[model samples]
Target chain A: MLARDDQPTPPLKRTPLHALHVARGGKMVPFAGYDMPVQFATGVLKEHLHTRAAAGLFDVSHMGQIVLRPKSGTLADAAGALERLVPQDILALAPHRQRYAQFTNDQGGILDDLMVSNFADHLFLVVNAACKAEDEAHLRAALSDTCEIEVLADRALLALQGPQAEAVLSRFCAEAASLRFMDSKPLPVMGLDCFVSRSGYTGEDGFEISVPASAAEQLATALLDQAEVLPIGLGARDSLRLEAGLCLYGHDIDTSTTPVEASLAWSIQKSRRHGGARPGGFAGAEVILDQLDHGAPRSRVGLKPEGRAPVREGAQLYAEADAADPIGQVSSGGFGPSVGGPVAMGYLPAAIAARGGVVFAEVRGQRLPMKIGSPTFVSPSYQR
Target chain B: MTTLFTPDHEWIRVEGDIATIGVTDYAQSQLGDVVFVELPKIGRQLKKAEAAAVVESVKAASDVYAPITGEVLEVNETLQTDPAQVNTDAGGAAWFFKLKIADKAELEGLMDEAAYAAHTA
Candidate 1:
């Protein structure tokens, strides 16, 4: 049945820990079709700073989880089949290791960015919440013949991140402290079976635990009981990721922006590029490889606004204050609590995308000056 | 001295012809944390309901409208450096600006403390 204009809007979905969030004074707001907490009673500023200093618990259960198992009983078969959709060296991924990848369209644009972890005999993928349905359809349509795509709907993802992450997590899962950055494995966390990954969107050292939906509240409650851990909401999550230079699926990297232009060429390994083994088989390989070799026409760069006023997303960028034509636009911008200033990311013509270059951003009918710099506003604290 | 509030969540403390303006405590709680504040220039003429100042939180920026027609007489310069004060003391020390009321008749349109409380409730 077709939806009518007079039909009432569908109600938002709630996570397993929704009740606990409300009990802790979380301010609930609609986000990605889920009724999620934007911040707790302590507020976003304190939550953001707390995550940087101590540990913070984040409910990322809204993201999609999928498993790709090879029908031929070989991990390479599934990795090879999956290579057709992404631009990463999936076959080279070691067992219990995770890597960042992006699903590219035929036009060299990003469909979605995801995390691919190599399990014992299968690949576990974590895709964005907004693009999960389309991603599942794309995977089934293309790789169903060689692999089995299982969508795990009965799971919840929680991120415990910060300097005290290892100290706090080790209390329940002692093996957690042993896994270095990018390591993934099935571990018993708080006596529950879970897929644990030593990776997160925030620059701080952390672990993302994938637990069963039924036991999510139990696990979250036990973790929050720690003195170092506090319930951080979506507001701090956005600012933390932004300060860490991680791209939000729809905002920083979208269908209109390629990985090369988005300054994510580092994620594209040499094995997937020209003259390497198994090169140019994925979608948009020709255009992506061309951008890789000759460089893209425009490049994404970090912006530091000179004033206290934040230069937010969609703010037009200009090279001159009086310029009639705009140069580019900010894709993601906001106040960074750790940096104690405003940080932004936007694309600029490659000719003028040099570090330390000055650009003007139009905010509230006023042209504010900003300096171009490295996108990683804060240094990463990953344990190798 | 008379205190009044507008539907937009701004509170004005009137003493003689000078009126001090700031956002209510409820507004500060909803806005979360105040990271920055942009005030109007002194001597600028503002019409009632006109966008006069800007209050920025970490997530978004909100416009503080003029509660009544007046000329900007002074602004809270302290907010430029320490905007967090708006969160700590929104009703008292975090006054946004002082306006020389151009027309005392505009005060009649504002709600008293009791009406504003009921309106917010």
Candidate 2:
């Protein structure tokens, strides 16, 4: 007997609110092994604008959520185990405060950037939906012998982002109003148990709530019922994050890019730089340390393409004179409705990045002039 | 005043020897957003089903093929600044280009509105 190849098997995973999404006419696409919405019936632009004016609900349950329970000893001792591998001031983290950092290879390149929030109970880890599998494998293989890592499989994550995000969220959790940026606390959302974090990918005031998988749909429905909330899909998410000057994992930053060269030096702590707790002994530490001493080649910068012609991903960036020779390429580029023009971000030589002004991007044999500048095209409205 | 529809959802509005071409409402809705559309240069010759234009959205890129052989007369300049017109009114306002029809016999191969709607459905 042989397996029938006539019908395509359904995708590997499903979100808690999968049925609700199907009911609302979501164009379900297989993304990162989960059946997720690429766009809703209203379309991308409308979804993007809705997130700006009111609260937008995002089903980010596909992202890997983990709980790290430290062995009883000291906070610094437990944080030191992780600090040896990734660069960040995790030990100094106050209970319930969150920190965004990356797991670095020895060469100082980021393996994966993730949100590590220290609650009174455990270290809550939120990793990229695409890189979740690799991240879990690496952590288990790397730290299994030393620390205990528990994969939070039964947990689901949701991001409520926009100007009116706090207003809607405050209705459920009154304690949420005083929570500063990068803060996480276990709060009751509409009588349901969850952890509400005052942070999100979009450059807006928002909360990321992690609830039990069984209760995910009820919570999503409760939030969606408010006139301020609408279901946002991956299309609006990509544009929103891009406009915020935030880096997307696979496209913008990869294992080849060091934190220093990628303009991510802000994530590297001063203590780590001067060898405070545990001298750097991870892979490629020497190269990373050396680069810290001097400067690294190729800095990440934003490009503003003149006119409406979008400079898409993988389009070559070059000096205007010698258009054939490439300087770098666009990692992510698209129309930014808030900026009222096309926006892009990519890597370029440090010299060009330092004296930022204008450069030409080669797209299908035409030289499209682009202005090199800061990543944040629109001012971030995060609740800090 | 003669307009014909292709099975692929392209519309050709024939006026004398020249015919204005664009995608139908069904095609635009299926394609989602219209971010980029590449049009052929004037005086360029094209064959039926040959690459006529390219429309790109956030997720996918599609080629707008010629329904019949013709010479490029004029391309839609409005799409350069406002390609979203295709999403708004794919048939009425977002016409891609006008092509000088090479053979009148090819018009018989196209489907009328009733036939096109049935074919698409």
RMSD of each: 3.2, 3.6
TM-score result, candidate 2 = 0.93
Which regions of candidate 1 deviate over 4 angstroms? Answer: A1-9
Could you report the DockQ of all the candidates, in the order they appear?
0.47, 0.37
Q: Is the docking of candidate 1 incorrect, acceptable, medium or high quality?
A: acceptable
Candidate 1, residues A207-231, lDDT tens digits: the string is 9999999999999999999999999
Candidate 2 per-residue lDDT, tens place, A285-309, comes to 7767777778888888999997667
Candidate 1's error at A361, in angstroms?
A: 0.3
For model 2, what is the C-alpha lDDT against the true structure? Answer: 0.83
Interface RMSD (one decimal) of model 2: 10.1
